[model samples]
Target: MNRTLEIELIDELIALKSARGLFLEEDIGHAPVERYASDDQFDTELELVFRRRPHLAAHVSELAKPGDFLRVDLAGRPVLVTRGKDGVARAFLNVCRHRGAQLVGENAGCQNRFTCPYHAWTYASSGELISAPHFASGFPDADKTQFGLTAMPTYEALGFVWVVPSPDSSLGAPFDFKNYFAPIAAEVSELDLADHVQVANDRISVAANWKIIVEGGIEAYHFKIAHRDTIAPFFEDNLSSFRSLGAHMRSIIPRVSLARLGDSPRDGWRLRDHANTLYSLFPTAQFLVQQDHVVLIVANPLAADHTELRIATLVPKSEAGDSELWMRNHAITRTTLDEDFALGESIQRGLTSGANAKLTFGRFEGALTAFNQSVADTIAAVS
Candidate 1:
């Protein structure tokens, strides 16, 4: 850890020890207050958090290579990320330089060239404007060089692709992901996420602000009440939540011992006695790291009251070959996510009733408070 973070961590540790299950007044009251979801000012905040952040997107090892490509929505714009013939990753606005049509509609695939659906405008993996439907006709002034797809700024590190929508955006700004995550990158790096591959993925839309849904995953305070049937039996009421870079939070739930049950043995199942780790990366990414696998939830907010949550289950390359574990984990993952989203959507409907203006964060919920505070700071700074 850096000296600055070390000092902050020391203070946090001291506070944690002294308060046990409460937050300091300064940590809560001193925090800035603002609406992140319904407000128009930070409309793109979720997008920046998901796609532009270096540490968050640094989960891919390579981008450009023979037949390598990925498609992602950068905020509302369609983005096509491709590895060129020269083995360099490049990102282009998915719109064809001709007539503003989407170049690639599929989620992801390896393609040597992209062909527009409306016209036959095609582009190479390098995003070079290659061929147009008809030439030497009505439009002789068209320049292929100038018509190449709008390329976005991209960089690859730690195995993921990071993109900046504004090509000329400042790289040294405070919100620059690398700077924002400098303090906690080591902690995140310890997970060795780059070593894992996506085993399964599923998505669902919920009626809730992105942050409201994120709040569901960041604190264990609700596990006892909301997930009593599923997660409560496995965790202790006393949970530890840590605030890290970019207003991200990690929740640690010490596991319970089930071996005491009549016929249960502690042999192979002893691993369950370890802690359950939950990580919520800004602005709305949730990751749960278990002994065997890592589950990532990329929450994309579409409206003030609607969010799309994508769940990706990742496993070690070796374990990915196991069909039985994949099947079992997939089912468990789906059921758990549905349970969370069901509640989150319900809360969204409730929050709009004017019955609740501000929600209080219990001492155990300090991480959520810290995350909201960070959002407030970012919005204020941007303004």
Candidate 2:
């Protein structure tokens, strides 16, 4: 983060401390229960919202060498992302051109070529078809070039790989990361995310809608109640601030220790020293920024009542040593997330019980409203 922005967010924190207040909206917000329990709504989200958004497929470090590859599910599409011998990252539909067989069964590995189990059709890491089992005898008139894997829109920057899973024409044609992020580009650049290496990886499945889990991350209102024995004591009482980044969000949740800074002459102050900054990379992911490391989380909604999160702990190269420390941190992070997600699951069940028509968001928890509004707006725009 820029020092100026750090100072600004801190000063806001200091003010909230003095006033014993939190960020508030002009009015409370209500979201219909249907948003979570309705099958049609979930289908629309998968088709409209997820398919059209950029997914953080993998951190570049995961593909440290040329020809490294990983298979990921983006939206509902099976995607194969590869770091080619030419040192460029690319994405393709993880389907065999010959028979639509699901190719690349492994989750991740270092391979320069892939062979279909069904027909033995081979493809290079660059997604070019290399050969067929019997080119001379079978379909000799077919063009091998036309049988190559279908390319998805792919962009690599700031040490991360981004791919739009859909074939939307607007995201194609060179597929640049839209300039929508231009405003916060400098702020994100200062984090030097590329300088980090992932130290841990885990997946957790929760019986809750994906948005419910996302909403939990952007608010501190439930910290004391939901994470009482875990992360609650360390943070303030419902105290945090947030700002919109295009359709995304950035939240600053301050710690109790921040109060100790106490009007002291400040110089070279850092936000991470006293708070956790959370970034919602809209539609699918969040980057929980801590002083020593970052936690990359991607939520994949499996159904109206189920979601799976892929969590990776990233540590700066300077702190990548001390594997035990990162392991402990990852464990603690998982514990806290489990606490939040347990409650999320409970909320989903409540929504199905027909107790309330809509859920309420207090004026202070404005980010939830903004997020839901963004979803509604996106789906509405094309409706």
Candidate 3:
């Protein structure tokens, strides 16, 4: 967020701390239990929500130099993003044109050319076909120019790579980065992610719906109780703030130390020192902003009740020498998120028992309703 707006929010948090109040919505809201337990709904989300929108594939820092490349699965389609010799970022289908074999199997690496393991078809980082092993008399009539990797719509903005994932015209065609990311673009720019690099990371599978995992970050109603052993002591009990950013949501969870800032000068106060800021980046990603590093959490839904969670801690390149601090940040995030996701697993297991017709969101937990509603709206817009 911009410094002016961040300072404004910090001031609000300070005042709320003094009054012992909570930032809430106009009224309470609720979501249905089936939203997290139904097969049909899960399929609809994969098709309508994930496929039809741009996905946060990787940070620009991940592909910072020429020949840098990374492979990712967005909505089940394997994609390869590369920083070519021209210093431009491009994305492809990650499939060799000669055969259906994957172009890159490793998650990330730096290579100017990729060779197909099946047919030895070589391709440049620019997606151009360089050579084939059996071009002499094997396929005399073949046009090698037609066998380059298929390109997808890709944009590099806000220090991240955004891809449509699908080359089809059915959805996400004519990708519009400006409008799609407009709501939070300025805020993200203020974060200067381009100047940061990933220092620590973890990946795990959680037995819960992706939505269940996301809802955990947007509310603090469970922080004190669910995280009593980890982060609860540092944060105020049931006191947090949130606001909608188009399809995204931003929540600021103030620490207990913030109460000491009452009537103090804001010039010396840093938001990250007094609170943890979480950004719900639309579909299946989150940014956990902390004091000296940012933790990115991306969820890949394997099923209605299973998700692959990847966490990466990014610190400013200037501070990359502080390996201990970055590692500590990653560990704390991993521990706290593990607690929240485990609770989500328990909720998912009980969601099918027909215990409640609808799960209610308290006034302070209103962002959950907003997020679910956005999911429903996106899915419904297709038909």
Give the C-alpha lDDT of model 2: 0.87
lDDT on C-alpha atoms for all candidate structures: 0.64, 0.87, 0.86
Where does candidate 2 have its weakest 10-residue lDDT segment?
167-176
lDDT tens per residue, model 3, 1-383? 66788788888987777777888788999888888989898888888888777788889888989999999888888999999999989889999988689989999999999999998999999999999987868879999888889887788987788887777444444767789778977877877988898898678999999999999888889988999999899989888888888888888999988878765887877788899888887888788888877889998887899998889998899999978877877888888889999899999989988788878999989888889888987788755
Where model 3 places Cα greater than 4 Å from the true spot, the runs are 133-143, 168-172
**Candidate 1 ranges beyond 4 A from true positions:** 1-65, 133-142, 166-177, 257-273
User: Any residue pairs clashing in model 2, and if so which?
Assistant: none
Count of clashing residue pairs in every prediction: 6, 0, 0
For residues 159-214, write the lDDT of model 1, one tens digit per residue: 45666644323434423546655555676676667777777767777877777777
Q: How many backbone clashes does candidate 1 have?
A: 6
TM-scores of all candidate predictions against the true structure: 0.80, 0.95, 0.93
Residue pairs with colliding backbones in model 1 are: 59-159, 59-160, 60-159, 60-160, 61-159, 64-83
Clashes of 2: 0
What is the lDDT, from 0 to 100, of the residue 322 in candidate 3? 79
